[model samples]
Target: MSLNSLASTIEGAQLVLRCKNLNDSINFLTTRLGFKVRMIMPSEAPTIAVLSAHGCTVRLEMVPNATPDAAHLRLLCKPALLPAGTPPRLSGPDGMVVDLVDAHAPVHVPPAVQEFVLTRLAGPESWGVGRAGMLYRDLIPSRLNGRFVASHILLPQGGPVPDYVHYHRVRFQVIFCKAGWVRLVYEDQGDPFVLQAGDCVLQPPEIRHRVLESSGGAEVVEIGCPAIHETHGDPGMHLPTGAWLPERSYDSQKFVRHVAAATPWGPSRLPGFEARDTGISAATEGLGGVRVLRPATGPANAAVESEALGAPGAHQGEFLFLFVLAGQCELGSTVLGQHALHAGDSCVLPAGADYRVSPAPGLELLEVTLPARLPA
Candidate 1:
């Protein structure tokens, strides 16, 4: 049969092993381990046997001088498989080792290694191809020692993306549309919608979603906690589920779509700039807050035209990141010194770090912080 025809009839997989004595290997697998006999070939001689255990299937073939594969097989199952005070390890008759691990281990969050990092737009060396063929520039090369991650991603040759219905195993995540637009769909979140430039969304943990397509040259800013996380694909899930449960919780965090045009811009909590709130803080329940910082426009922002984000100490969170969306700005940090940042430049500040932002003409900066609110 042709490859396509054969692929159509494909099913699960079974590991193959060579054994010197098929009966001894079968007895050891069935008696000591929790495997059940499935098939025995050539009933009279019984030189081949197939056994199944815990969703895994194995085939044993008797060979006078067979040597087992040196591969290590690790299985996630109940710890009760081994006796008390015994390690979850065993050796098969073929000399292969099996390791049992707890299936429901608690989530691991790496400790934060606080530091100051700066990425310049001129650094073309940082941009590389990432998932779904999108170009990604690592804003935080260190990832703060894997405690956090921020990226400037772009879809240069945009259109129908290869992304599918999936979800992230993340403590927190947010994506901002920096330029162009992209169509997206989330589980039980109404219909497929377009994420226009300047709009942002909070993708709480395990919220199944997909990126259907994007306009040409679309750019986005993606940030997540713990830096390294898992993206699980659900091929069975269909986008737009046709269910509009806006308040649904994905493990205690709600999904939020902050539209730039609809959101009202107001005076910033800081002295010299106006703020456009993304409403992420309330959605994540103090997990974090995201907003756009622009030069103060009206009376509320008239008094001080110097400090845009804050003077030195206004909002202090465990993590803080800033991306220059447009124009230029001067960032002065007490501990890290001063630097001039232009469009496409990004910066990361340690928790409780003293810093100030001075916006130049038409400066539009994106700010993100953890723990959501500021101590007024």
Candidate 2:
């Protein structure tokens, strides 16, 4: 068996150190190093004490013969989280060495209110192919003040795409195939699979993947948090190269591949509209959800109510948007008065905004929102 086959997921790591005086060591870590005491062995003359600071945890054990040349604790922390001009190394009461290393800062703040905006494709002349033979049209540029971006990607002459194995450092992201098909291979996903129209995949952050091939005129819609993120190439790793482990996790999230044809249409927030869940909710652990919504066919306006036609209701999230796949509709809110939507139209609904959508019969919408679990 390989080493990876025997390895289990590690939740966290805590360093153990020997200290001659636990009380003095705790005082130095708390007062000098800005660490907080999480626990202590005893109220009087404690032998062990747990200290935490800047994402680092340490267990200090009182030892009678402890010396300064004992094991050292190396901590990785964001530079901004630590005090300015903090020394790289520090000594505790028993000569315990603690090394602090600079790491990338992780900070996120959602918008207070959602921004109502819209975009429409001009014409074929505007669909110009760019890098990697992919034509991308940004959908939500002003939404969440550019914290999130939804784009329409198309490959006019798709085949073996000019791409490389890579991964993205993002909070949340997903790709839904709108037209044609594309083949993709992700690390630990077994083999390359083709994503047909109506299929979607929730790509967890930092998961290595690659776009292998695509049919001509293939189109897809990709939504991601923070609007911008880095896509780093993995020259050392190759897809379908590792053991097949679908249950394997990347940054506390699992990869999800949802097929619209396999998923049944369920009830949606709007009356008379049915939704097809994309499994992104469970994948993100309530971080976000994607759904294909369509109005139930029968009467043109049987379930439409004048009072609730445009009544706005607020939602709790960092991002929310809709991409129209077919038919037309009118979305309205207190902030953004009635706006017409048609095929290929994309709209961004800001956070905590009251909004309503009145769709015409046969209207199809691809909806995405952050924090899959939201207040009704």
Candidate 3:
């Protein structure tokens, strides 16, 4: 797969820790708190440990050795790190090397506080390999034509992530809770929405909100129209102002109390979303606490004639995810080399990927499009 062509871009001013012995260091970090492994790259040789993590979706990656390929792995790993031997002051690609060095100089956050933070954040559904903090994960952003910004996020159970929201810009937020649940407090609306496991919530931009609290934390995969950072406004936005739903919410409290609580909301179950057109090989569909969409039929052959020079009529500039939930697909591409993608596999189409799918029944996918940046 093409690394640069992959969807998603990194965010700004986030934490990214890099080290030589990634596996062991990650193990230590996760054990301490506020970090969990989400995705891990496939490795056969015992010496190689190429992995990434979401420091709240700020990408962090590592390579076990300083081999040539590991260099590519290292560069690719740090969308943030700077060139080597360039004076520690000039470390990150961004102008923050000096700042990072200054921060690292003082390990001010006490170990107790770090552990406390870890207890509050939630875990993701697909915790790829590794234990806790050192788990493998990737942050694949969906940036179409270098304009629209779509980011994937993973929030680990942790300490206090104070309740707050951003006011600098507007955005349309679609959040999917794959595993665990969180309590959402909308300052404007007043009442907190107890989004349970498998539930989805759509919040309009500039809506003041934050996670009042969480139980077992929660794994939230959020896709938004236009991504703008969410920050707390002035002190005016605080608790007691937003209604906190303590009882209706189903969390560890429910099981602890022995109440028969059920999910209160879920994703849209559009009919055409799961159905394959024709000559398709396989398909899968699910709604409720989790959503999965996959192709039922195999890949379709390109007519290879008159339409070769132009874009498809109906869908233009739209991105698609060919997700393999069960089997594999023989992915052919002019740029990316040929490979077989198995279940839990995903590929992104920028302007779009032109490839024929092999007849496999269990490849599921979800197609998401951001609202036009400027009005259509």
Candidate 4:
């Protein structure tokens, strides 16, 4: 048959192997081979089992006289797509040989462009209708080559929103309440809670959540990785109905909520600024960090010492941004020549560029960086 004809007739291909012991083979495939058990035949003393990994499926049939030479399996995938530490070859319980080959496709990466971003007060023209008919403004239009997306969302009409329970498949994301207040609920987080100005939440990947209501004019700043991600609706599940699981993890990430009022300012790397950690670092497993920063009181011109402000250094990650929340400041970096930042003004600093900020008294800013852990 022609290749096209054969492809048309096949839904999927599964390798069939004979195993001396079914249970041992199943255990080896799942525990060592990293395959998920899809099905097992016969409730007790099963002779057949199915397993899958990386979209490839296989069936193991138990037989008294099984041999490794019975079948040969070869799988191909991009080297970058394989899980870290995965070996190139693996032997199953019945001496089955599996060869893993690299397809060597170029990784999908955002384009490289000189970083430059400036957003003014979002006017009617800047606002666009988004999910649930809400208004949104692109805060970082370039989004660091599509590695991240920062948006300003506003609920114009507000109250009893018809938002559905949904979750995103993002590497990292955080929402900060910028104005007014919003009510929201999350899976396993008991009851709906209101998020006021300055409050922020780290919504871990795949954690179902819903926006219940908001006061008119309520605004929020949201940042997420990859700029684009899937938002899947969970019609079968509802939020705020289960016991709170503060320590529970979803996809290796934990949810975090930081109330500005309850969080205390701590010493910052910069002498003149105090910072409030938004608990995003812990939730993202070193993928990101969020900090609310403001000039420490008692210093009118508390300039960060030039000697202390190390030479411009570039980050090794995808994104770094600073948003002025209040007052004014002068920021200098290798990527952004010394520039003044006012309330609502922001800048994206390219990775590997050393930067420094000089704040006027009472200046407040929001800073975010990917890969929470920075190299010294």
Q: Per-candidate TM vs. native?
A: 0.76, 0.69, 0.40, 0.68
Task: Give the runs in model 4 whose Cα sits over 4 Å from its true position.
Answer: 1-114, 305-317
lDDT of candidate 2 at residue 183, scale 0 to 100: 98
Error of 1 at 247 (Å): 1.0
Order of quality (lDDT): 1, 2, 4, 3
The lDDT values for all models are 0.77, 0.74, 0.35, 0.73
TM-score of 1: 0.76
Local accuracy of candidate 1 as per-residue lDDT tens digits, 1-376: 2545323323434466889987689779978998866555332235666677887878677889987666445555555443456456656776667665665555467887768899998665667766556778888888788778888888887789966677777888899999999999989989999999999999988898989999999999999876766555565688889899989998888999999999888867667788899999888889899999998765543323222244455344577788999999888766778899999999987755677777777889898988776542
lDDT, candidate 4, 1-376, per-residue tens: 2435322423344577888988788779878989865544332125666677887888787889876664545555554545557667656666676666553322233664547576766459888766655777888776667677787788998688867777776778899888899999999988889999999999998798999999999988888776755555566686777779989898788889889999999876556677899888888788788998887777534655222224434555556677887788887766567788887777776655666778887688887877775543
- For TM-score, candidate 3 versus 4, the one ahead is 4
Question: Which residue pairs come into collision in candidate 4?
Answer: 287-371, 312-354, 313-352, 313-353, 313-354, 314-352, 314-353, 315-351, 315-352
Choose 2 or 4, whichever is better by TM-score. 2
Q: Candidate 2, which segments miss by more than 4 Å at Cα?
A: 1-103, 107-113, 124-131, 298-312
Model 3 agreement with the true structure over 1-376: per-residue lDDT tens digits? 2334321221223344545666665566557654544333221112222222343422244545533221111122232343333333224343334222321121121111000000111246434432222233322332322222332333455544433443212233345554565676654444655666545554443444556655554555544323223222333456436454423222111101101134222222222224322110111111011234343222332111111224321123333333343455565555444666664345554443334344345444333432121011
Worst 10 residues of 4 by lDDT: 305-314
